[model samples]
Target chain A: MKYSPALQGLIEALRCLPGVGPKSAQRMALHLLERDREGAVELSQRLQVAVDRIGHCVQCRNLTELEVCEICADTRRDAATICVVETPADVLAVEQSGSYRGRYFVLMGHLSPIDGIGPEDLGLDRFERRVAEEGVAEVILATNPTVEGEATAYYLSDALRSRGVKVSRIAHGVPLGGELEYVDGSTLAHAFSGRRPLE
Target chain B: MKYSPALQGLIEALRCLPGVGPKSAQRMALHLLERDREGAVELSQRLQVAVDRIGHCVQCRNLTELEVCEICADTRRDAATICVVETPADVLAVEQSGSYRGRYFVLMGHLSPIDGIGPEDLGLDRFERRVAEEGVAEVILATNPTVEGEATAYYLSDALRSRGVKVSRIAHGVPLGGELEYVDGSTLAHAFSGRRPLE
Candidate 1:
């Protein structure tokens, strides 16, 4: 159907979002125009503000308005330990868990050779320099358990080990509250192989 | 977690979209910041442009950059037959069906006394005037099947009938390609009651 030029432009722009199709784009456009004009204006202004101000933390590559992220700037966090993660979302997940008190090193993405993403692309050189210069004692590998994550973890382990830092991978086990029967075979195998003796 | 001010604002703004919660808003914000910066800029620009340029069509209340919507301004459509719908989205749906060559009258919303939406709120007075002035022969009620939709349809039917105009409600029956067994009881009942005789 032929929508007005402005409405059509709005719909096309909305389609850029993840999982949003043409129908959803149309619905969103109409809803914004009809009922939530103020909210749409706020969203547009915020989008511009976020794009202009939010940038990667110089210290850990996490999102921040300043030079370094809050976590990296805080003196309370364990400066000697760094958790390596794939994305800023992963940092949020680990923070929500409230179990990890160390700083994070966000890779932004894992090593994807097919996508031409290598160690240089992930700022691994900067990470290595920080580990050595900051006297980090331990490096935690918290990348996803996928093939790419595993490869990146291995590479980071080797790179950090040369700097005299201990490297550890987060345990691969059935998630807390998850039944053993529902756990996939590969995860169960990893859990079994990495089993610790009952204290 | 404590996000940067701009990032937090962006996430909050994203939550204004229908069905988008905090988690999805966060994901969208990060995705736009990390992967699709250009698309985010485009979306923001288009949103501003749409809000600035688009307005309700003077005649049909559908979205338009001009004074009247394209469908309403088209000369080929049957101006005597007006399809009354609850929203601009509904107008698009009818247009896409390709069967209806009639012009549309968008109500923007249905009547709901609880929400303080009365006849005047939906521009019913304007609709009445248009029917008489334009020499409208038929008014097709294409409102949704919800209770409010039914009430609005009934209200319009009565209002138009007093002005000596023919009013017809869109049929409520089993949808095309729907199997009788899988159809809901209410829909099956509607189909049974509205069944047509074989020629």
Candidate 2:
């Protein structure tokens, strides 16, 4: 059941992707070799270029080719308001919503004390300096509603409040399309507690 | 919502894989860029190597770095008995079973007149020549049990019978580990008609 060396190598390499297992890796390798040679070559070249060129944005810690990310560089975006997220993917998600015109800060990961990740690991000190020096008036925490995300938001709120920046967390509640019956207890509780009066 | 040029290219290229849509492609691109840079670089290099080197086997149309595939090159297999399959993936599946010790001929696809695919497209002429010149005794039609596959099998049987070679189609029946009640009606009928008495 062993494939040729080149094919074996390709299959093994493809397994590095998240959720791709041995069977899926083999299928992908065969598919690329059999049907999409040109696309495969293009993918290879692009992968190399991305790996070599893409780096963390200096200002926001999001992935970028330049020193600062596009969001951080755009003068039209509200530099006075910074929305913080756990990963670059989250930055993309928020951008896709198109409701926010502010800049972003990617923590790359949430703090996990058991894993030895702390405020320094998430570049909170640098973020603090950016808030003060760049005259950021508001800091919005948009991290996920998990335990670590909540803990990170709490820590960042405490750390930034002394610097005179208004701190706020994104609302936690039932998702827009989610049925109330299907919504979990904690989320329902949060939604009820955070209810606002109609204007 | 636009990614950098290199990142965008990588994501688009990744979409060429089967079952990978835009969201999965984006997730894969970000995962490779953010978490597994070294693995990403290796995958890129391996993809290039595989694409540059792997080609169809001259004898069986299976993938190989050599002119002939490993199975075709092997001296221990029964060259006189050739198992014909619709795709190279089927060749791997049959090989994994370890029940057949014969050589293989990959048709690459089934006969579909509406799609303009014919016996010539499946390289049946070359296969006929191989059967006559190489002294092949048996030709096993292991194509899938689909409409096009059944038509192809019938065509091959008629064509090869005139050449005095034994042409046999693989049995169509209930699959192993399948329950009788759960099996489809056509497959159950096939199993009933093709049944043999226990020895």
Candidate 3:
């Protein structure tokens, strides 16, 4: 079917979202096409504004509007501690739980040699430099529990270890309130190996 | 937690999409915040462009830039045969099957008395006048099989029958290749009641 150039263009742009396949993209496009033209236009406008105005904080690579993100600039947060994560989404997840009060260092992505993404790709060099220059006492690896995430954690850990920064990897395997019978074998094994002494 | 005005403005706008709850909206907002400025600005530009450029076709209510939709203007299509539908998405479903050569009349929505959306609200007035004047030979009721959809079809049928125009509803019950055991009881009942004479 011959769709208007504007509709086609809009759908193509919307396809960038995660899990929005062609059919869903088309539906969204048509929905936008139908009711709320003004709202749709506003949404499209905001997409550009957001992508333009938002940038990585120079200190931690977290999303920010200024030279330093709020977390890095805030005096209430512990400047000596840094929770390193793989993406901005992870930062939100951590923030949602409201447990941590320290600053963060976003890796942007994890190491995957097959995809040609390695240590250098994730701003580890900058992190190492930060550790050397800043009086950072501890670095927490909050990367995902996936294999690639674990691998990236180890790489960062070893790199920061020589610089005299205390490094710790976040625990993996077995979620809270999960049934023992439903737990996978691989996760069970990892939990056994990573067991820590209850102080 | 407090957020920058620019960041929050963009995020607030993005929360309008379907299924995008507050937390997901935050992540999306933060994601866009961190990306290059060029993308967000470009998205804003596109939004206005799309809204201004796309409007409803006069004939079918489908999204279009021109006075009449492409489907309405197609010479090969049976203009005398009209397929009545509820929404733009439903129009696409019929189009994808590629079986019908008839043009369409999109109601934009179905008649729902409980929601205060009546015949006039669904553009049935325009449909009635168009069928009468357009030399329309047949009106195919291709609306969904839901209660509202059925009510809409019956309403349109009764309203148009007095004009002596041939109005037929699409067959209900039993999808092609659907297993009998898995079919719902209501659908099976519909199939049995509406069973045609076996050749």
> Which is the leading candidate under DockQ?
1
Sorted by TM-score (best first), the order is: 1, 2, 3
DockQ list for all candidates: 0.81, 0.77, 0.51
Clashing pairs in 2: none
In model 3, which residue pairs have backbone atoms overlapping below 3 Å? Answer: A45-B44, A47-B40, A48-B40, A48-B41, A49-B40, A52-B37, A54-B33
Model 2 quality (TM-score): 0.96
Provide the RMSD of all predictions against the true structure, rounded to 1 decimal: 1.4, 1.4, 2.6
Q: A54-172, model 3: which lDDT tens digit per residue?
A: 67788888766788987788899988999999877787778878999999999888899999987777888878998889889999999888889989988989999999999998877
Task: Tell me the tens digit of each residue's lDDT in model 2 across A1-199.
Answer: 7778899999999999988999999889988887789888988998999999999999999988999878888999998899999988898889889999999999999999999999999999989988988899999999999999999999999989998999999999999889999999999999999999999
- The clash count for each model shown is 0, 0, 7
lDDT of 1 by residue, A156-184 (tens): 99998988899999999989999999999
C-alpha displacement of B49 in model 1, angstroms? Answer: 1.2
How far residue B66's Cα lies from its native spot in candidate 1, in Å, is 1.3
TM-score of each: 0.97, 0.96, 0.90
Every prediction: chain A TM-score:
0.98, 0.96, 0.92
- How much DockQ does model 3 earn? 0.51
